[model samples]
Target: MDTSAAARASVCRLPRSVVTSVHTPVSPVGRHLVLMALCFPSASMCPKGCICQRDPHLHSLNVTCSQSRLKEIPPTLPVDAVLLRLDHNQIGAVPDQAFRGLRVVRELNLSYNAVETLGEGAFIGLEESLQVLDLSHNHITRVHRDVFARLKARVIVDDNPWHCDCALQQAISGMAHNHEAAARVLCRSSDLLDQDGRPFLAVEIDLCNLAKRTTDYAMLVTMFGWFAMVISYVVYYVRQNQEDARRHLEYLKSLPSKPKKPDEADDISTVV
Candidate 1:
């Protein structure tokens, strides 16, 4: 082989790292740009009117849509988002399975919104990964008992118009990991106005018993209505039968008495 061919063979035999190091070193900024490109979602994937950043420590996406004038949750959200902030928006309600696609979200902030009621399964996909759910300063009035029962996250539900009734009591009591927050829930509305504005847990009334009593009263009223209907029917039947008997007697009286048999009349005249 020629000398030039031999030199090329030697160069090819060098280790891969040595060959790569011979090229110009990439600057820190270039390395950062590469990392961001690899970690962060594309602009098209990010929801409109929102900011999405990658958490270097957590190695996950952090999506923030706070104060974005969102009337409702964006239909499409980055699926890899682990922290979502939607506070200070105009969202009115959380529909069922609202976050179904965001299975990895750990912290969800929905405070300062216009959320009035949480439907069942609103947080369906977050049950396993969700750590903190902030719902403070909303317009919530009532929630289903099963709405928060499955969530193990620390829920913040203060500063809302909660109707502290049996349903509310059950919903609050279902929060196993949020006892302190539950204890701080004040009654915005109650059966008795005196109990309003008081801590729901500190109230003296038994909501379950009250609910039971109310149901019992309703049942009693229904039963009495049925009884009255049956009694009225019996009275109407008796009056109708009496009227029918009187009409039959009047028909019998209207018929003229048959004249005595001719033989009987002749026998009577002969005896006279």
Candidate 2:
């Protein structure tokens, strides 16, 4: 063999152990760093139309994404996220399958959105460990009974259009007994409120003037019926008492008043 080829062969024939020692396997910590960078390109890297940021704490799983024009929820959210903020978006509804794989989510903020209709059974199979649900500032027209039935957390549902009609009676009554429920419900829809600028509470009954009028009319009818019955009973009692007194007076007149004893009758005749 030529001297150059012999030298190249010797260089290529280095001990396998020496090569292995020089090229050790990647450390777990380094692998994790690479994964994070791949998962999130930047510290505040969100989707083109979304605004979001991951938590800096390695032990904490917190993310805040707000003010995005997201028409729906993002699918690939971090599964380990515990505190999530999704505010001021255009999320119209939470489909039943929205939180399918999110097992560790605890506090969720869904405020200042356009959520008009939350579908029935929307939160069917969410993580049982969930707590502190915030649905403040939205276009929710009504609360379905099933919606509350599926949740076991402290619900904050302030500033939504709660139509207090027969459709909401059951839901409102049920909410009354839930200790974890909040007490600040108000109507945010002008169309649902009456001409007055007041909210739709019992004290502000006249705010929904039409509904108030209808309720007053019903109460008036019931009161009139009761008053008529009372009057009829009183008239009957008075007439019966008057008739009894008349009969008693006639009987008194019929009875001989000790019959004016014969001797007393004769004395009265002589004096006359």
The candidate scoring highest on lDDT is 1
Off-target runs (Cα >4 Å) in candidate 1 are 1-37, 266-272
Candidate 1 worst ten-residue window by lDDT: 1-10
Candidate 1, pairs of clashing residues: none
> In lDDT terms, how accurate is model 1?
0.83
For 1-272, candidate 1 gives per-residue lDDT tens digits of 23443343243354445334433375645544433444354445788999998765566788999989999988889898899999999999999989988888899999999999798889998989999999999999989888998898999999999888888878887996798989879988996568889999887778988989999999999999999999999999999999999999999999999989999999999999
What does candidate 1 score on TM? 0.80
Over the stretch 43-109, how does candidate 2's per-residue lDDT look in tens digits? 3423455434555444446667687677777766666666777888888987766766667778888
Cα displacement (Å) at residue 79, model 1: 1.9
Best by TM-score, which number? 1
Clashes of each: 0, 0
Per the 3 Å backbone cut-off, how many clashing residue pairs does candidate 1 have? 0
Which regions in candidate 2 have their CA more than 4 angstroms from the true location? 1-23, 27-58, 174-182, 187-272
In model 2, which range of ten residues has the least summed lDDT? 195-204
